[model samples]
Target chain A: MLRAAVEAGADAVYCGFQNATNARNFAGLNFTPKELQDGVAYAHTRGTKVLLALNSFASEGRFELWKHAAECGADCGVDAFIVADIGVASHLANQLPQQRLHLSVQAAASNPEAINFYCREFGIARAVLPRLLTITEIRNLKNEVDCEIETFVFGNHGLMVEGRCSLTNYAVGVSTNMDGACSPASHVRYERDATGGMTANLGDHVIDCFAPCDQAGYPTICKGRYRTPVREEPYYAFEEPVSINLMDMLPELIGAGVDAFKIEGRQRSRTYAGQVVGAFRKAIDAILAGQSPNPIDLIGLTEGHKQTQGAFLTKKWR
Target chain B: MSITPLAKLTLGPILFHWDAAAKCDFYARIADECPIDTVYIGEVVCSKRTPFFERHLPEVIERLERGGKTVVLSTLAEVVLPRERKMTTELCAQSDYLVEVNNGAGLGPIAGRPHRIGPTLNVYNVQSMVHLASRGADHFTLPAEIPGNVAALIGAAARPIGVGIEVQVFGRAPLALSARCFHARAHGRSKDDCRFVCEADPDGLQLSTLSGGPFLAINGIQTLSWGYVNLGAELDAMCAAGICYFRLMPHRTDMVTVAKIFFDRLAGLSSPDEAGACLSALGLGPFENGFWHGRAGHLYHTEPEH
Candidate 1:
């Protein structure tokens, strides 16, 4: 996937060790030490940077694990460490002064004060803004913050505040912030109901049910359907499963002083990531060259075959 | 055995959007009659709701202080707008009352100053706690879903730094926060034109599963557990684990009586079972204590299961 993304013209590719150190701690995903070394060597030769994601909040009495991951990532010659925890950032700033640090979106540094905190405390070179800000808010934020700003251009349009949400932890006891996995696959169960409907569950809790003709979505707690007294039928109380596609707003985001555009879904397939990256690279180049970019077809690849501009375009999304 | 049997009871800031008059009345009652030792005041959820109550803060603070309650101002849990940043900065700058920093945005201005870590900030490990403590945080309120083992470890780590650890022993656990206001959305309105729809549900609008089982509650942009978190059975265990403070999140219920019950429980005037029964008799629950047992937050683990 690193080679594919680099070849697809990604300036930087971020990945993680096969452990709880990163947010995408899915089984059969992520890299071993040798795999990371190989990926870094391959990307560096092609003028692409490899950023290590040590983004999960360290569990109590488990800071050594994150420290060890950071040491290993450094030894592997990665470009920078994308960190979320203050302890990890402080450690890197003091111990490995030369290593560049980027604040992960998992840090939820949505404001200038929060971004400045990391930049001042840990000498963070960049901060990934959470996906909750509108373009106007982003522009205002860029004026006050010292570090480079990165915003998500594509992928999951999470409704909840990053790093702060514990819906998954409340359900299955595995936390996205601490364990780096939300709605862990091990606890998810899909069962067929009597009426040819499907019920998806996380642990013993029923997250949602889909009729025979409906396409079932992942059993994330936020995307699930629930009943309320006001409505007779079950409804998506939080959000419907939709992917965020910001291709149309790329020019405005660039004008908002965004440093880089991030494409989420590290756990996705190489083919899909490469296709999306290649499409984005072309669009960005066209915009820089003062031309209207030709749109690329990515609807089929989106979750639930639906896409939304999310909270980026206007405050109406709220 | 409980190491600190006499933990202080605290009233967490009101998460719901009550009218200023209702808020003042609630606090006046709390200040005069409640046994709560510390009262956290400020808007911790939505930044838009701040203006409605900002004018009443000084009066509320004076009343609480006059009643011999230690008051702490809390910052917003999520800040994205410039005004929100300014609000956090100004809150951090105030030195009269200790501030509880809920978001990372609050940390910068309060750095090197004595403050408290609210449950919204992530302080899962000892290193994070130590680092924040070095930056002058004297106390912490763990996130609502933190399990007992992790809380015990954090409490143990906090001991050496002479910092206090607080856990929410009562309330509907705050499960998630979002930029989108579900309350307004449910009413077929956008957030900017919300018209204060959330003010209708004083205890948060309830959301149940499709099966009609209680699932979660929505209060504006924040999601809370449908079941009230009652850790009456684990109070002694928490105290033994070095937890010296218990917070009671204010709902529309009679919080004064709730605080008295918890105070009595801590003072050993009532047994755990007695306290648990009293809380149940209040009818504010279909109670849950699963997070303490390292299970689902909505589950109520029996004594045998524990």
Candidate 2:
């Protein structure tokens, strides 16, 4: 997947170890140290950068796990380390002073003061802004902070505030902040109900039930249907299963002084990564040449085959 | 021979959108009668709701101070708008009262000054706690979903550093916060023109699963558990683990009685069994302690009696 993304015109590729040190701690996913070293060599030879993500919050007795992962990444000669925990960031800054550090979006540093606090405290050179800010808010934040700003342009739309949300932890024992997974597949169960409908359950709680004709998305707590007094039928209380696609607003985001564009596809296939990256690369090149980029169609890669330009167009989304 | 100090009872900031008169009355009762030692006052959820009670703060602060209660101002949990940033900055600039920062934006302004870290801010481990403690954070309210073992680890680490640790021991546990307002969205209105509809539910709007089981509560952008977190059974254990403060989140229910219940429990006047019976009689619906027992937050696990 790293080779496919780099070959498809990605200037940078971020990967993580297959452990709890990173956020995507799923089975049969992520890279080993040997794979990372080989992938870094391949990307660097092709003039691309490889970034290692160590974004989970460190537990009390297990702080050494993150430190070990950081040392492993450094040994593999990665370009930069993306970190979320302050303890890990402080460690990296003190131990590897020459290594560049970028604040992960899991830190939820939405404003200038928060971004500046990371930069001043840990010598962060860049920050990935949380996915909640509008373009105007992003531009305003970019002017006050001292670090480069990155924004998510496409893929998984996590509507909740990152790093602070504990919905998954509430329903199940694991958490996105601590355990690096949300509604982990180990506890998710799907069964056919008596009414010819499919019901998705996380632990013992029913997330939602879909009819025969409906497409059932992943049962993330945020994108689940629930019963309420104000409505008769179960409804999407928080958000619908839709991926965020900022393809149409690329020029606006670039004009807003965004330093980088991130596509969230940590769990996707190589084909998805290649096709999406290739399309984005073409559009970005056209915009750089001062030509109006053609509208790109990548709906096949979205969740539930649905997409929305969330929060970037307006703060009224709240 | 070491003597452990008795835990202090704190009243958390009101997270709902109540009318100004009702807020004043609530604070008045808290001031005149409640046994809580510390009172946190501010709009910690939404910035728009701040103006409704802003005019009454001076009187509220005066009344609480005169009543011998320590008052702290809390910033919003989520800061996104330009005005929200400005609000947090102005909040940190004030020297008249101690501040409790709920978001990362509040850290820089209050870096060198004495402040408290609210439960909304993540302080998962001792390293994170010590990092914030080095920057003038004297007290910290750990996140709601952490188990007792993790809390004990943090509590043990905080002893020699001379900083304080707090945990939410009562009221509905906050689960998640979003950039979009679920309350307004459910009412067919956008956030820009929400018309303050959330004022209708003084406690919070109930959210249930499709099977009619009460699952959660929605307060604008904040999501909370439907079951009240009653740690009555674990108060003694937590105190033994070096926790210094017990926080009670404000609800529309009789919070004065709630504070008295916890106060009596911590004071050793009532056993865990007696306190558990009294708390259950409040009719606050179901109670849960699974988050503390290293299980799901919504599930309850009755502790074995000592």
Candidate 3:
């Protein structure tokens, strides 16, 4: 699936180590050292770049682990490193001066000054923009900054603070920034309530309860519904469980100087990755060729059986 | 062993609404009475509130500086408009005070300058911290959810690079910031035409779960933990971990007393128990330090030193 992504249209295939060195650190996903070496080789052979994700924050007294992971990734002959930490990025840039570095979206370098600083000091070649940008803001950022820009085109729409937010950790004791998992599956449990509805609980928090007819996604704190003083009823306080589909907005994003479009699931199955990557590849190619791309049939892949353009379509209330 | 008096106090930007006169009076009082070392002033929640405080900022900054406070201008948590970006850029260019890049929109203009990374910036690990420090960030205010161990590690790593670390100490913790304003939506108004109704609840409206348990608070688009976070007791552990600064976010209550409680704790004049008792008298709520101890943020895992 990764090889196909490179061959189809991807400029770079970003993957993470199996451990907590990356944000998508899940139970049965990501690459080992040997797997990363083989993956890099496969992409290199096909003239595609391999970007290693070491984006998760290194915990106290555990800096050496993240440092070693970077060294191993460099040894694997990866094309570039996507990083969020200043300490890690600086270490890699100082040790491997010739290696390319891309600021991970987790870094949340949303402004030109921040991007320029990364480029000048650590030689960052690209930055994965946070999902909070408007089309006009992207154009302005491109004009103000020298490095390449990447945007998320599909997957869970993260509306919280990118890179720095720890709301999940506050709620459930795990966070994507430190632990590389938000509302991790280990803490999640589903049980049939007295009403015969399945209640999904993350830690002690009941995130959602669904009837037999309802579809469910992973129980995340931000996607959970709650009753607020302003609203008399329970509604999504942060954001609804929705996937970001920019298939229709591809031309606009591309025209706004977006250098790359990122697909957000590394924990996804190889089949899911291949299908989404292939569809986006075709859509992007069609747009570049001045033809209207066919709408992607991605309803089956959506969470809660729904999708939205998220912040890209302006502010959402639900 | 006594903890060293190395904990620096920072005043976070006011996240609530106040009249221009009251806002001016707040800073005036901080300048005259608060023992805080740094004061962050500017609109962090909504841009509309910026205009109200904008006219008073220059004077307030002057007063703060006269009182020997290192003033900082903060940026909006969510920046979706071109004007908002422009405002961030202008604030960044104000060479008189350091800038706190709360969101990514503010980073571009102030990159490679001596700036403070706000909690909203979501810096969870050493790599992200080092990245910001290399970009001329001399200091960082970690996200509220960062565990003490992680904070200590980041602080230790940052020490060699000559970067300072600050953690949120008092006030309702800021959980999330979004483009949609629940305060306006609740009042049946759009964000574009929000009637400045957030002023109704200076400390944010408390939210309860469906079962009537306290869950969170809503201040505009931001979702905050309903429990106030008081780290007066964690000073020794944090100081041992190499943290140099502790931030107390502004609240509607007695901020001077809040600052004094921390000051007294640091001075050994008051124990963590005494400080915690005083915190209750200030009328916030039950306190929690679980997130600081690497537990649930809302859970009070550590027993207070009563």
Candidate 4:
């Protein structure tokens, strides 16, 4: 993706170690220490920066690994560290004072007051705002917050409050907050129903199911289909199977003073990553050049082959 | 050896909206009869609902104080608006009560002042605990879904610093909070025009799975576990690990009896199994203590003999 991103005129690329250090700790992905060293060299040579993603919450006993992740990237001359846990932030602030820190969306620092706390104490240069914030809220937050604000512009839409959700933890033993997986494939069971439907079971519970020939999404408890006995209908009570595509909302976000555009799906393949980065790259550059953002045709990679502007387009309560 | 404090029963701030009369009547009962040692009084969920119950705050505090229960006021979990920020600031400024911070926004408001940590703020690791301790936090309630061992480990780490730890031993555990009001959305209303609909479900409106299984509850901006997290059986384990406070989140049930069961189990007057049965008889949905075993929080596994 480094070459693809640079070739696609990207200014920066964010990736993480293959271990449990980042939020998307999928199989056969992320970089080793040597790979990171080489990747940083490669990206820096092309005037494109490489930011290390150590965004997962690091709990007790595993503090050393998270701390090592910070040291590993800092030694590799990486541009910045996207951190979530206060423990990880504390380590980066005290030990690697020179390394620039960006508060991860996993920190859930939505409001300016909360974001400023991290900036004042941790010296964070940027904060990836939680997807929960509306454009108006983001615009309002930018006026008061100290650090640069980043918001998700495309890819998977996580409806739950970032950093604080336990819906994954309750149904599955692992959670993104504690364990770096949400409905991780290890525990997910796909079974064929008598009616020729596929049920995505997270452990013992059926999170969501799909009819035959219907595209199925990863079983996340919040975005799953559910039924209340009082209501005869089974619907996506929390959120539908949709990826957020904010290409149409770029100017509004830019006007709202969003410093960076984050593309979700580090869990996707490298080819998938490059395509998304390249697509968003063209759209953003066009917008920057005072031209209308040309919509990128990338719906095939979406959860249900559908995309939404999500909370961005919603008229939030004043 | 460090002194392990006897786990005292405490009542958390009411998360659901209740009318002033019912709210007063409930606190009156808690103040008059319940064996809880502490009572947290204030609106931690929505700031708009605070005014309806604000006038009765002093009387409730006075009544609880007279009943020999320590009362602490709690700030809202999420503060977005300018008024919410001012409200949070004013809540922390109160000289009469020590504010329990539900969000990090309160930390700045209560700077250098002794405060308590609510479950809404993530106090997962020892470093976060130590960080909050340095900022004048005297007590903490670990998040509802955190592993029991992690809570105990945090409690142990906090003991030396003179900070107390609390575990939510009962009630529908608060699972998540959002800026958007899910309760309002379920009713086809925006948050501003919510019309106080959350008051209808005193326990909270349960969100179920496609299989007709009750999964979670929607209480305005917060999503809660449908199963009341009754750790009556695990009180022995939590108390042994230096937890000083046992928190019971208020629900529309016979809480005095609920308190008695936990109190009896803690006092050695009843076995945990018996306490569990009595708690089950209360009929507040299902019960879960799976978080204690470090497994799926919704799944139940009997405590294996250590």
Best model number under DockQ: 2
- What's the true lDDT of residue B252 in model 2? 89
For residues B1-306, could you state the per-residue lDDT of candidate 1 as single tens digits? Answer: 322434888999999999999999999999999888899999998988999999999999999999999999988997877688789888898788899999888887788999999998888887778889999999999988788988999998788889999999999999899889999988888888999899999889888876668888899999999899998778878888888899999988889989888887877788877887888878878888888887778888876523
Q: How does residue B190 of candidate 2 score in lDDT?
A: 82
**lDDT, candidate 3, A134-194, per-residue tens:** 7777887899787998999998888765675666777787867777887788889887778
Show the lowest summed lDDT stretch of 10 residues, model 4 chain B. Answer: B1-10
lDDT-wise, the better of 1 and 3 is: 1
Instruction: Work out the iRMS of candidate 2.
Output: 1.0
Tens digits of lDDT, candidate 2, B1-306:
222355889999999999999999999999999988899999998898988999999999999999999999999999988889999989987789999999989998888889999987788888889889999999999989888889999999898888889999999999888888888988988888889888998788889988779999999889999999989879888998899799999998888998988888887788867877887787775888888887889888885834
Superior candidate under TM-score, 1 versus 4: 1
Where does the lowest 10-residue lDDT sum fall in candidate 3 chain A? A309-318
| DockQ-based ranking | 2, 1, 4, 3
What is the model-wide C-alpha lDDT for candidate 4?
A: 0.82
Writing each residue's lDDT as its tens digit, candidate 2 over A1-318 gives: 999999999989999998888888887779999999999999999999999999988877878888888989999999999989888888899899999999999898999998999999999999999899999999988999999999999999888988888888889878788788887899899988888889889888899888988876778889899988887878889888899999999999999999999997678898999999999999999999999998889998999999998988897787
What overall lDDT goes with each candidate model?
0.89, 0.89, 0.80, 0.82
Chain A superposition TM-score per model: 0.98, 0.98, 0.95, 0.95
- The DockQ scores of all candidates, in the order shown, are 0.74, 0.77, 0.46, 0.55
**Candidate 3, position B25, lDDT:** 86
What is the lDDT, from 0 to 100, of the residue A241 in candidate 3? 85
Which ranges of candidate 4 are over 4 A from the true structure?
A316-318, B1-5
CAPRI grade of model 2: medium
**Model 3 lDDT tens row, B146-249:** 88878888888888888889999888888777667777766767677778888888888776654467777778878788899999888877877789898998
Checking candidate 4 for backbone clashes, the offending pairs are A226-B209, A226-B210, A227-B209, A227-B210
Off by over 4 Å in 2: B1-4
